[model samples]
Target chain A: MDSMIQINNLKKTYSNGFNALKGININIEKGKFFGLLGPNGAGKTTTIGILTGLVNLTSGNVLIDGYDVIKDYKITRRMIGLSPQEINLDVFFTIKELLTFQGGYFGLSLSESKKRVEKLLYDLGLEDKVNAKARELSGGMKRRVQIAKALVHDPELIILDEPTAGVDIELRHLLWNSLKEMNIKQNKTLLLTTHYIEEAEALCDEVAIIDDGKIIAQGSPKELIKADGESYINITVNKINENILSDYNIDINENIIKITSKNPEKDIPNIINILSESNIAVRNLNVKTASLEDVFLKLTGKNIIDD
Target chain B: MINTPFLTLIYREVLRFIVLYKQTIMPGIISSGLYLVIFGHALGSRIGSINNIDYIHFIIPGLTMMAVINQSYANSSSSIMQAKYLKFIEDYLVAPVSGFELSMSFIIGAIFRGVINGILIILTCWMLTDFNVHNYSLSLFFLIITSCVFGAIGVIIGIISKSWDQVGVFGTFVFMPLSMLGGVFWSVDMLPKGWQFITILNPLYWMINGLRYSMIGISEIPIMFSIIISIIFAIIFTIIASVMFSRGYRIKS
Candidate 1:
């Protein structure tokens, strides 16, 4: 499959001598839901900024639909729609006006822009607030307007930078449905960056974990976890007895016992039997597979959701 | 064929101010009126005539030109600065619009506001006092070129200014004093030799003189010189603004 976006050794060094991006490379396949997951200040936004031409790349090239971002900006920019991390919108313009104007910015004619604006307003559930000022809308509504503004041009690829940030659960689900519809039904290629591990796990077909200005891991969520090749069985008992754990490699934290195993199917039942034989009342038993979070922790030695 | 991004940006810029007309237009009109009433009445009698015209008549052109200058400057400075402050300028930056297109859209929007304000002040002068436009075509020429000059200057300021307070400082310390000292209330001949020499160094003086020549066939300097200077200054300010836009000063990361 042809790539919708191909980044070749992209690097960005800020004036303050901070190397925000250090020769990172990525290729997003056409019509695929790709997630770039990272912690804060992990070069996710910088990469997005360079892709959208907000930040200048220090060295290397980025091609969107086979066109260089700098040499062929007009064609490249027209092919990608960006929902930035920040709420960069005119507060005074109405929702409909923002969409229409964004369409026009991409060279859409006035009539065509208006038609697209109407459809996007209805699709995004902003029909009732079409005439409302951007500042008047709630935070979720503002985020929706940003998405509508990005989609008004109908680009081939949509890049969302932290689109669900600060949104409530219901709004997050609503956005997820719309995004899924765009990716699945409409066959639009998506490149999303987020800190939400579950969002990446649930929606993205391929995930890339970037840490400290580098891509530390990349694969499907399940494949990434399976490739880590580690599973754990957690058992909560009424009391911990050191004599019972003498033969097994187990971590005892208060009344909880955690034992790592290569295979959970064989190890979980054995652990449960040992707990039962020890006369320890089993309060809880959980078999944990390696998740994307665990994979991230193994690769970077840091949690994904760190303040 | 699709319309250019420049066209859309211009439409957006003009529409932005029109939607906020009370903030953009009303203050300029009210201030122009106050200047006409207070300054015209207070000094019209004491300073009887300037170069064979009444003080009221002489200052009408100045007041109208002043309004054009301030409005032109304010329109672009506030418009572009607001986009930067709110980070909405990224919309244009990420789009296919060129630097020239972005810069020209702002300059054109500022010219529109300046010309509109000029017309309103001229109409207000005609209705309230005995003011006449001597040469309609020449007046249009001066109004447009002078507005363009200030509009370009505004775009330059807008690109370089980092804060709203910086914009306020420019208006207060730079634009306002320059306009007042540019012979808005009095003629250059009334000043001493050294002051007259210093006043001629101000660009707004030439702009005001050009407008006065257009409105009443009277000026502190030769009409040809004023016209040439205004056109030259317009070109220079436009080049400066265009260069700033091309460099993405304070705009692109």
Candidate 2:
């Protein structure tokens, strides 16, 4: 497996003695969208900070394309681009100025920066906003500009920290499509953290579910569901008769009763006969497969606030 | 991606203030001009002939350096504090740019503001009194170097402060009193002998003396010490501010 980033037993203990990352080990392959899933304060930002060389780590190492981040910072930094959670920009600067300046920070000549800025603005649907001040940009455009600024350096690895939060569905799809193109067309390695479970499930080929500074589950979304057999049967009684559920083999689960017996069809007939005799009618029945969100909620036990 | 460089950083800082010209530059100029008008009206006529020069001529250097120092300090302190408050400074942290680059950028921005203020003050004073600034080279040298030095110190203040309130805390508690007592509008020689010695220790006193020497061709303190002290303060403050930045001192939070 060709890993673009390999973090080994990564740990970060803050000055106040908060352990943000605990023995985290993960390998991200090249040209793939790797999702780092966690509830708030589960240390997603901290991990991103460490990988991008912003936060100091107490122990362990991060290797970006086999380049040690600490020992060889220049080369490692050149390989990665970080779109931070905060929209930090010189509000006085125009979008074109910001991108060109960012390009210059990467050592590109004026003409070269100009070329890159033009292409990026056009690609990110920011061509019309090239002259707009950062303060004048809408929230979605600002987020896109942030991404464009990061891409100005043209790094192989791009780390987006919650890029889709507070954005409308149209902009979300726009961002996702651009990110997908970055991965599939340009072969960039993208590490994105998102609040949208659907976004993660639809986009990521692999995910790590972190809770309380530990990885509880890490696998493909489909494989995670398969690994747990996250499927269920639900049967609701029509009438208000508790007796239908009692004196029966059907397992009760809140409003919807359940049964995991070998023969659901055979068991249904018996359940119907017993419910009819007790004056309880069958209202609704279902056999459903679990979604990625169900697996996420079950593993992490925190509602992922899409807002 | 842009490669963060020393020049790029400097350009950004310069652009930062220039684009927001009113907030950074105009107040200093207008304030200095008002002082020139008010003080030139009230005191210039009464305290005549200090070391064979009119009161207004004697005070021009002091008022000019005063504007430079205040503006330089405010620009650096306010900009950094705002960045910190808005949580926007992490952009610099993740970049390959070194701490020295960031510190120098802010300091240079302060210098830019200070120098512009000094020029405005000098121009206004020239129009009001037409004072034949006796030694042009010395006055120019002192103004440039002093503004640069005080501007660097502003970077130190910005690095040390946590909030906008802290700016007032430092400015009112320290800069205001020290500047007033530094003999901007008068001579230390006019004071009692004991107080004169205390004036020698105030760094702003030497700064004013250097400017005085340039404008009126005389100074209470040796012009040599004034020049040397300004350069020394510049080096000390630069070293301190850069060290704070390099260690990631206040930026992490």
Candidate 3:
């Protein structure tokens, strides 16, 4: 697979002597929905800023579509659209005007810009708020408009820094469906950074979890969960037989059997069979499979939302 | 070659002032009108002509230049300060616009505002008093150069300013006092020898005198010297603003 974004030894030390990025490397393939998951100060926004030319890099190189971000900024910036984490819209302009201006910035003609703006607004459920100013809309409505602005020019790569942050569930699902459609049907490469682990798991093909300005783990959602995530099987029985379950890793309390297994699906039947053979008389069984959230907690040693 | 993004930036900036014309434009016209009513008419009656021209007519060009300077500076500086504080400047930063293009766009927008306000004040003078522009081209040259000078200064201030108070400091303390002491309402010859020396050192004096010379065909200093000084101010400020913008000084991290 061809890489759309290639970052090598990227480092950023802010003017105030804060180390935002400590030589991180990231490669995102074309047409892939990639996610960067990290805490609030984990350099996610700084990385996005460097890619979009809003922030200068302290050292190292970043390339988009084979063009260096610094050397060929015009070409690189023209190929990517960014929806920043902050609500930074020009409040003076209406939603239609703002999106139209954004398209114009990417070299779209007036008619072409208007057409794309209309289509994006309709798809984002912001058609009614098109004539309204950004300040007039609710927070969720403004988030939709931000997405529409990013998609107006039809850039090849889209960088969304917390696109669904602070939005309601309904709007979040709406944005998710639209983003998935763009990735699947249009073959647009998407780079997303989010605090929501489930969002990353559901939308991203691959995810890199960064902590303290370093990428701690990188893989598909299932791969990370399988490799680092822990699953548990808790079986409640009328009576516990310790010797029959001695062949397995089991923690037994008076009448309950707790088993830790890497493959919960394969181990549950075996455990049940052994209990049946030993006449343990199992009453209830509960299996807990590891998810992306669990994997994140285990890797970072804290919740993604922890400040 | 036409650059659509650059043009769009200029258009957006120009539209910003137009959308807020009540704040950006109305105050200048109203203030200039008051000066004409109270200072030009009532004060002119008490104070006779100073340089073979009527007092009311003598202040016309100075008032017009004042409009150009104030509007030009206000447009660029306020526009940038608003964008900065509101965090909408990221739109321009992320775009394909080069630093030079971004600087020029804001300057061009300032020029439009300066020229528009200058023309409106000139029209206001013609209606209220016997004022006529003696040299149309020279008057226009002064209008444009003065706007360029102040517009560039506005950009510099906007980029370096961290607060709204800092943005207003230049207009209140520097430009306002200088405009008053720049021979706007009186001739430099009326001052004492030492005060005259101090007034000549003021750059605003040259700009106001240059525009006054164009309007009334009279100036205390040579018209060519005033033109050179105005151009020098424009060039220095433009270069500083362009360099600051290109370097992303205080704007990008």
Candidate 4:
């Protein structure tokens, strides 16, 4: 599949001599939920700002559907919609007005903008709040309005920057489900920058882990988990003792004792005894699957949130 | 397609001012009313007449236009500047609207509010002092266009302001003194020769003079000069505003 957005050595430097994006390159596939997964200030938003034309690029090129961002801004922006990280919708305008205005900004005719607003409100589950002023809506409702406004142009590629930053668990699930269906049923390409790892893992088809103005890793969620072939067996015995668990080919790595094993079921019994007899103080332990968090930790030697 | 985008932005800007009527329009009317009641009644009696018209009658057009320009410019300029300071312009920044379209919306919004305030002030003047507008056409023309001109200036102010406090500085320090000294309470013909030359330099001085001429059949400067200055300043202010907008000045960073 052709990339929806292609970055060729894109770089961005701020006025005060801060290099926000340093020689970055990314290829995002069409109709895929791609995550620009990184912590705040890790160049995710800066990269996005450059792509959306809110922040100018210092050097290099960004192509959306083969059109350079600066050279062909009109067309590139026409095909893209962005819901910024901040919830900054106009407080006075109604939900319908917000969506209608968003459609208008894309040069859509009044009748067409009206129809698009209706469709967006319905799809985003904001049909009830159509006439409600933005300030009157609940936080979740307002968030949905912001997203609805973004989708008013019927953009094929949608970029949501930390879309769930201040939302709750239930509301987040609702939003994720809506986004999931949009990508699946409409074949919309989504670029989601989120701090929520588990949410990204569930929604994103592929993830690019960026740190310190660079992409450290990029791949499908499953591929990333499998590519990390080794699994650590974290065992907590009935008793407390790190030296005893080491006899069963186990290597203790700070905090908890660990052993590299293909199958933990076979290794758990032998490791459980040393803790039970020696009373090493068994607190809690479980063999969890290697996730994107572990991948980030392995690559950067620090948690994704930290970097 | 181009016009649709333009209309969309203007419609939103119009809706913003009207929807926040208490915040944008009412304050202007109330402030202008206080000026009429306090100054028109008190000073009109003491100062008597200027060029055969009551002081209350002579100052009406200037006061009305001043209020119109003040509110119209403030509404648009502060609305956008606050949006910028709050970092909300990012919504429009990420949208597909062109710079010209965005600038048009803001300028038009200011014009709308200014015209509305101008009408209210004229109506109030008629009610308060029985000052019948002698040339209705000129009054309407001067009222509408002057508001548009100053409104454009407001957009430039919005684009240039880095903080909300800067907005206050412009209003309190610059616009306030210019309007008060621009002859909202007096006439330029009454000033000394040298000060009269300085008054001719103030764009609002001509704007108020034009509106004043329309209302009372009297003008310190010729009506044609006033109209020419109003049009010239409107164009200049618009070019300045649209240029700042097109460049994305302080906003795109």
Candidate 5:
């Protein structure tokens, strides 16, 4: 597949001498749902800003498709649609008007803009709020409007910066389904920056974990989670004792004991037999695979929401 | 198709203010009417006339220029500042529009508001007084040039401001005082010789004089000089604004 976005050693330093992005490189393939995970101040938005021409690069090159961002901004801008993390719509404008105006910004005529707006409003489940001012809509509806605004021009690549931040679960699922449909039916490339590790695990085919202004790890969610082939076993006994599993890295809390097992299938049975011999009845047990959250924690050593 | 982006941007800007006409357009008309009543009616009889025109008539040109200048500056400056604070400027920043096109759209939008205010004030003046517009074509020419200059100045102000208070400071301190002392209420010849020279140096004074000449065929300076100064100022401010945008000044970083 051809690369949709290519960043060659990108760097960005703010006026206050803070380096937001340090010698970074990334290439997003065409027609892929890519997730960029990072903690606060991890340069995710900074990279998005550069890609959308909202920030000047300190040094390096960014190519969208085959066009350099700085030299061919017109073409690059027309090729990408960004729904920024913040709610930046004109509050006075109605939902339909905002989408129509945004389409016109991309050089669409009024008739063309209206046709696209109608479909976007209907697709995003905002047809009822079409005439309502943006400020009058609920938080979830406003987010849906932002997404509709981004997709109004029908750009080839869509970059969403935390599109689900502060959104309710029911609305989030709706947004996810819409995005999935777009990615599948339209073959559109999407770059999603989200703090919800579970969301990334559920939707992203590939993920990149960025920390301290650098991308520390990048791989498919499952590949990154189980690349070490590590799993864990949790056992519940009728009673808990400290020295019961001293030969392993065991964590005991009350009547439960957790152990890291290289092979859960083989380890669970042997561990159960030992517990049976010790006069402690094994009440329940289960094997748990490493999740994307664990991988993110292992790489960054901090929670995604923490600074 | 060639003018789609440019025209759309201008349309959006124009619609922005038009939708908020209660806040944008009404205030200028009401305020100009008050000035016509207080300054043109209450004080016109006492101040007598200048250049063989009634004091009420003489002040109409000045008041009309004031409306044009203030509205032109306020329209662009407030529009940009609002977009910046609301973070909606990212819409254009990420779009396919060029910096020049963006700047021109705002300038033209300001001109629209400025011209509207000027015309409304003139209509109001005609209702109360018998002030005749001496040269219709020249009056339009100077009105457009003045609006362009002030609108360009507004863009520069909008780019430099980090907060709305800064915009207010420019209006209250810089623009307000300049309009008052720019020979709006008095003639330049009334001042001492040295003071008259200093007064002529003010661009706002040239704008008012140019407008007065267009409306009444009497000016403290040559009409050509006023035209040249207004055009040159507009060009210089436009160039500065375009460069500031291209550099991504405060709006980007």
Candidate 6:
């Protein structure tokens, strides 16, 4: 598989001696929807900054489409569109004018820019705001404008840094649908850094969770859950037999039997069979499978919202 | 040939000032008009003429250069400082533009504002009084080069400033004092020898004198000397601004 972004031994030590990135490596393949998950101040923004050339790296290298980010900045920058975490809009101009200027920065002519801007306005549900200044828009509208500006130049790789950080549910759903459409139909590569683990689970093909400037786990959400997450089978019986269930990790409270297993599907039938032979009547049964959130908590030992 | 991205940045800078003309352009013209009324018409009768020219005519170049300097500095510095404060500077930082192109764009936009304001003041003088430019080419050169000098200084201040107070300090303390004592109203020779020596050291004095010579064919210093001084300051400031921008001083981390 051809990688669209390759980060090798990346490190960034800010002027105040804060080590933001500590020689971390990440590789995202072409047309892949990749997620970088971490707590606050875990070098997510710093990594994005280095990739987009906003912040200089203290050491290490980054390549976009096989071109060095610094040595061939012109080529690499043109290939990526960054929707930063901050609103950072020039509030004075209309949305159309702002996006057109963004296109011009990427070398698009006026005619081509107009075409792309109009299309993005329609796609992002911002057609009515074409003539309104950015400051006049609502928070969700401004967020949409940020995305429109990023897509105006038709870049191959789109980096969204907390794009849905403060948005409402309606807008988040709208953005997720739009992003999924682009990744699937347009074959665009997306690198998303988000605090919402469910967002990563729903959208990313693969994910890497970073903490304290180090990546602790990386894989598909299902694979990570299977490797590190635990499932539980809760069964309520009229009567319990402790001797028959001794082979499993069981916790009993009165008439309830809770068995922990890595593979709940294989263990559930065996437990039921053993119960039936022992003349134990099953009144109720519940099976709980692990989610990405469970895996994140198990590895990081902290919730995503924890500072 | 300039690339599209560079031209686009220049267009955006020029458009910003033009869009806010009531605040950016009108203030200079109105202020200069008031100066002509109070100092030129109101006080000209008592002071009479200086150096064989009408008192009103004598102050035209000085007033015009003052407007050019103030507007040029204000446009570039305020534009950049606002971008930094508002966080919109990240747009330019992430764009595919070279440092040279970005610096040149801001300087060129500032020059445009300065020249426009200077020309309007000159035209104002022509309507209100019978002042005609003695050397049009030389007057334009002074307007452009002086703007270049202040515009470059403005970029430097904008980049290094951590707060609005820092941005305003340069205008309030340094620029105002030097401009006031730079012979905008009275000739340097009118003062005593010690004061005359002090006024000549002012860079604004040379700029105003350069424009005065171009417009009225009268200057205390030689015309070539003023031109050389203006060029030297322009080169030094431009080089510094360009180098700072390329190095990403106080901008990139």
Give TM per candidate: 0.92, 0.86, 0.97, 0.87, 0.94, 0.96
Tens-digit lDDT track of model 5 for A198-228? 8898878888888888998888987887664
lDDT ranking from best to worst?
6, 3, 5, 1, 4, 2
DockQ measured for candidate 6: 0.80
* Candidate 4 Cα misplacement greater than 4 A, ranges: A110-119, A122-125, A228-230, A234-257, A261-286, B30-34
- Weakest lDDT window of 10 consecutive positions for candidate 1 chain B: B244-253
Query: Model 6 over residues A1-307: C-alpha lDDT tens digits?
Result: 9999999999999999999899899999999999999889889999999888788899999999999999998889889899999898887688899899999888887678989999999988899989999889999999999888789899999999999989999899999999999999999999999988889988999999988888889898889988998898999999977889999999999999999888898999999999999999999999888888888888888898766
Q: Candidate 2 local accuracy as lDDT?
A: 0.80
DockQ, every prediction: 0.66, 0.32, 0.85, 0.53, 0.75, 0.80
**Candidate 3 residues B1-253, lDDT tens each?**
6688898898888888899989888888888989989888998989989778889999988888888889999889988898898888888988898888888888889998998888888888888877778999999999999999999999999999999899899899999989999998999988999999999999999999999999899999999999999999999998888888777899999
Q: Mind giving the per-residue lDDT tens digits that candidate 4 earns over A123-237?
A: 7777788888877888888778777767888899999988998899988998999899999999999999988888889999999888879898889987876775346777644
lDDT of 4 at A1: 86
Chain B TM-score of predicted candidate 5 relative to the true chain B: 0.97
lDDT of 1 by residue, A162-217 (tens): 99999999989999998999999999999999888889988999988888888878
Worst-scoring 10-residue span by lDDT in model 2 chain B: B1-10
lDDT of 4: 0.81
> Would you give the TM-score of chain B in model 6?
0.97
lDDT of each: 0.86, 0.80, 0.90, 0.81, 0.87, 0.90
Off by over 4 Å in 3: A243-249
lDDT assessment of candidate 3 = 0.90
Which segments of model 2 are wrong by more than 4 Å?
A233-287, B1-4, B133-140
Candidate with more favorable, higher lDDT: 3 or 5: 3
For candidate 4, the iRMS in Å is: 1.7
* Candidate 5: CAPRI quality band: medium
Clashing residue pairs, backbone N/CA/C < 3 A, model 5 = none
Could you say which candidate leads in TM-score? 3
lDDT of 2 by residue, B1-253 (tens): 4444556666777788888888877887788778877887686787677888777777788889888888888877877876777665666666666677778788888888788788877888788777878788887777777767767777777777877787779888888888889998888878999999888889888888888898778887778898899888888888888887767776752
